[model samples]
Target: MNLFMSFLLLFLLYTDKLAGLNFNTDVTVTWGQSHVAKSRNGEEMEFKMDQYSGASAQTNADFLFGRFDMRVKLNSPDSTGTITTFYLHSPNRDLWWDEADFEFIGGSSTADYKIHTNLITDGIGNREQQFRFPFDPASNYHTYSFFWTPQQIIWYVDGIPIRVYRKLSDSRILYPDKQPMKVYTSLWNSTAWTGEVNWKNAPFSAHYRNFYVNACVAWRDGSNVSSNCKIVPPFWFTYKLLPLERDMIIRMREQYMTYDYCNDKEKVTDVTSIECANNP
Candidate 1:
């Protein structure tokens, strides 16, 4: 870890910033309630799965726009076929689907841990980017958060910026700025993506703690705000990057970023993504 990251983790550990919280009532189980189990240490809500079934859950309500943070520790021993996800999904999927994803792809060892991030708009979810962290994700707990606003979407891990996605100039490209979404986390079998659902070993568990949401009544355009929404400052939500934030983005892309769909020439041979061209 870098100097800044080390200090941040130390501070969090000592200052109750990363103190584990019980989520017995904080969330709602959307599916596989029988598989929902708490951790042995009582620190977090554990989503356990076996060969027979999988588990998934989500927050109670849909949020307009907010900063959602989740501190999680991935499965450690024999984590193969355990696909852990923390993401936001749009309610209006039939009309148009908009979503944000953080998929921890299953691998043989800790060295193979890849964090897959994506944004789906208008049911087109090609905006995919995968990354590798310097530290072993299974070794310790880390906070992953997303800052969503009318301007852009920013992904952060351990308080450091990893990716920033902004709106494109083209009207055809649908951005995730207009719809409401609900937070969801799931532990399931993703054999098509995560190799095979290795169930012979059975019993895969994922831990989650400290789910926080700082909300706002944001909209893409200058439009009607919600009734209970309070007036907010302009600087409250913007993609204005700090010095360290900019540095982290560069560092992640240069050192750890593995796959970016926009940059793949073969994928976008004839039709380049407007979001990629404009952002770059």
Candidate 2:
């Protein structure tokens, strides 16, 4: 195929695979509704944060396992002390609560931001990994995504796999397979994690568009729930990374990764975790 035809074919296939979600029907503004705005007939949404409050939205239904994607442009210049996030979180906040996060920590300049990723299982979370963006994330929208299944979780930036967490042969390591989670997006201030805010640069904003989800929806409590809803699995349930994709992940980590909890000897004295083991 010609270059133009090949590009067009790929675009068409991707759109067919993951259709865009409608904001009005698929999600609800959980907090700071006044600061949230929708455009492009509700296909695009923006979250604004200030000294007083921030904005947040969450998916209306719970999903067991899936691939979730969002195009995001973070808070711009002088956004210190702010955080923009897209994550999946369990509604139950009990001892076994689980979460997966993609947090953008704002810095003094648009190009200075960092991507912080973490996975929490059974209410314990120390597996923090951070990476520096290759370009200014706030300058344009980029697709950030994660694929979750029974065996592994993979994080992506602009469709490039950046990180992977797999369930090892050892069964002792806790995985987030049991709980159903809801997708969420938020823009908030967090001086503890980012940095002390210059209140002069208040009213930060983050834009999110082209939300997509391809996953198994959990069955709600009802009189006529179907058995198929709880049994059948999707193709992604057994997905594994190709050799080329694995090589790309290694290259991306080598070049852009800033911090990894497993490699921190001071903070993580126990090297028993699979991620800490050689060749893991």
Candidate 3:
């Protein structure tokens, strides 16, 4: 890693500045008495939930304002599911689902986060938005992040920013505007909206480790934020951010650098970029 990135990685390893709050390492709770797979060393824990629930449950500690980051590796193949999510909710019981999150979705090793502007009353219409970013999450480890202020929310991956969504309202009551939010993390299988239920190829697993939070900056905009704030860096972000000379930079930049959006055929140029093009 480059000097800056190396230091940042080390800081992430040793400090909780990234997560914005303290985490209770010894505490882990689950719904329906989930199963846990323990590592031989007895240091790591994996929580598993079977069966599909239309809704998701949560295991949370307390926090109101700050950044949240976690290292996670998702489990086996799944065609339809909600994946895992990190969230915060309004302290008021009457306004549940008036929250924000770093939601991990299945079938693709990526993170999708959203903000709900209203209570969990009307479905999908309460001024909600989503951002999806790629992570070779299964083959290796990756970091997920969220930065929240009273008016804005930012999502990141490995210190790389993916989305910045803001609440644009003047009404204080409807806004989760200034409420201290409690942190929550949970896993659920949402086969209906996510896609077809393909258990034959599914029931995939996801793993999480080295979770941390740091509350450094107060809620504000126009800070010395990284350039990675708007764009989801290429898959080679970790590799490219390493210390290297100019030539190496060019070579790595060329081979791995691409703007191929699978859904946007207009951006895809080569035959190799075509999905199933070799087939009938």
Best by lDDT: 2
How well does candidate 1 match the true structure in TM-score terms?
0.83
Model 1: lDDT of residue 245: 64
Give each model a TM-score: 0.83, 0.89, 0.55
Model 2 whole-model lDDT (C-alpha atoms): 0.82
Error of 1 at 109 (Å): 0.7
lDDT of 2 at 24: 81
Better of 1 and 2 by lDDT: 2
lDDT of 1 by residue, 84-112 (tens): 99999875558477899999876777788
Candidate 2 local lDDT, 155-247, one digit each (tens) = 989987888887776666668887788999999889987789887877889999999977777754652322223666655578666555677
Give me the displacement of residue 24 in model 1, in angstroms: 3.3
CA shift at 158, candidate 1, in angstroms? 0.5
Best of the candidates, TM-score: 2
lDDT of every model, 2 decimals:
0.74, 0.82, 0.45
lDDT of 3 by residue, 1-280 (tens): 5666664664455354343222224334445334444455433445555554322333344443456666766654443555566666643456243576555556532332221111221111132323333445566767776665444455555764444444443232233433445555566666665655456643445455665665322222343222222254322222222232233323432443232133355534453233213111
- Give lDDT: candidate 3, residue 206: 49
For every model shown, the clashing-pair count is: 0, 0, 17
